[model samples]
Target: MIEFLLTLAILAGINVLLACGFNLILGYGGLVSVAQPVFYAIGAYSSALLSMKLGLPVPLAMVLGALIAAIASFGLSLPSLRVSGDYLVIASMGFQLGIIHIINNVEFTGAASGLSGIVSAIESPWRSQIYAGTIIAICAVTILAIRWLVTGPYGRAITAMRNDEEVFASLGRDAVHIKVTLFAVGSGIAGLAGGLYAHYFLFLTPDQYGIFSSATLLTMVVVGGAATVRGPVLGAIFLTVLPEAIRFLNLPIAVMAPLQGVIFTGLVILFLFVKPEGLFGSKSGGGLDAWQSRAMSSSMRKGAK
Candidate 1:
């Protein structure tokens, strides 16, 4: 039971990081992207390959993996600047599909066979406990960092951009820079999660980081309350644990998997219809209208000065 609990906690921590990344772009920056899992796969593969084949230390490999994912984010963000709304969504979907195809076809990625033998940083009878602690600490620090970002100047600019890009530009803020920076940060976070995931499982498979995983991560941000610090964390915990909790029902394997999906879909629909702002989000009409309004006022004041 303790081992099961520890596993659940670690999974929740990873999902927290993933959802936070998605929130940074989709929730705070107002960019729609479905390519998060691509960065995730990059991070996983980079970490696995570096540690397993190149003989790099696990920690260093993880950092490099995240950096690589951040750099790769530019490929999408640059193109995204030309589109918005549905078009941007379509572009992101294409990127997601394209990356998956590359992963499946690339020999170094182990192609459809997947990679194995990921060395865990923590080794011992206590590895589970230590890993869970590490994940928790990382997640706590990340949540605090995200809180800081959302409350700082960049946060204000992004919120303003989300509300009205033209107005944000008119106020002397460069929407392009803000969007690109947020995208990179978000993708980097996803990469970090991926590295952690790879080391924890000590295995890698292309199928694990597919469109379904992307949707699950997005669902966490949406259900948790996008644009809020605690929302994604809460949502990640709920969703990560919910499936495991359902397993206690002892339902047939075929019935259990689809049942979990049904429950998840129901929750998402319920949230969309009944509480679109999410549990922790503001009840006001716009997603972050209050913050945007304040930002606009502040910008106006600066202009007058």
Candidate 2:
């Protein structure tokens, strides 16, 4: 039982890393970039190829992989910024499909066979506790780091851009730079998650990351409530463990997938109906007490023009 619980905890932390990283783009910067999984795949493949093929140390390879993903994100940003809303989503979907095709067809990435036998951060069977502790520590550190980031000057700029990009630009703040930076940083976070996931699973595969996975991450950010620090983490943990809990239902593995689909769809619909802002987002959810919701609503009504 302890062993099983530990596995759940580790997966939960990973989901937080993935969700929060993408939150920087969707929630804070309002960039709505749907290609997060592309960077994630890039990170995983880079790490896997380096570790398995080139025989590099795990940590170094992961960092390098993340950097490569960042560069790729920067490339994606240039053509993407001019497009926004649903149009931007369509372009991002195209990019994702194109990238997945390249990944599956390319020899360097093991083509459709996928990459396997990668290393993990955990070192020993007896040291499972230590491994779990290390992962939890990383998650805690990330939480603090995000808190610091969201409360600082950078946070102000992001919130401003989220509320009003053109107005922010008119105020002499470069909205384009902020938007692009948010997208890149978000991708970097996704890359980091990818690296961790690759090491955790000891394998890499193109199908593991696709449009649906990207949508999952995006759903966490959106339904978790963008513009709030706690939402993504809360949502991540819930979604990560939700399936694990469902696993104990004693259904066949094939039946399990459909059950999960139904569960996720229901959760999404319920979240949208009750607290469209997210379960833990906004001070109204459980934080400060103010008329912020009214203010947000008023701003939206006026900004529609």
Instruction: Estimate the TM-score of every prediction.
Output: 0.91, 0.89
Residue runs of model 2 more than 4 Å from their true location after superposition: 283-305
Residue pairs with clashing backbones, model 2: none
Candidate 2: tens digits of C-alpha lDDT, residues 46-114: 877787888888888888888888888877788987887678788888888899889999988878888
> TM-score of the candidate numbered 2?
0.89
What lDDT does the true structure give each of the candidates? Answer: 0.85, 0.76
Cα-based RMSD of candidate 1: 4.1
Per-residue error (Å), model 2, residue 7: 2.0
RMSD of each: 4.1, 3.4
Q: Residues 145-177, candidate 1: write the lDDT tens digits.
A: 988998988777778788777778998889899
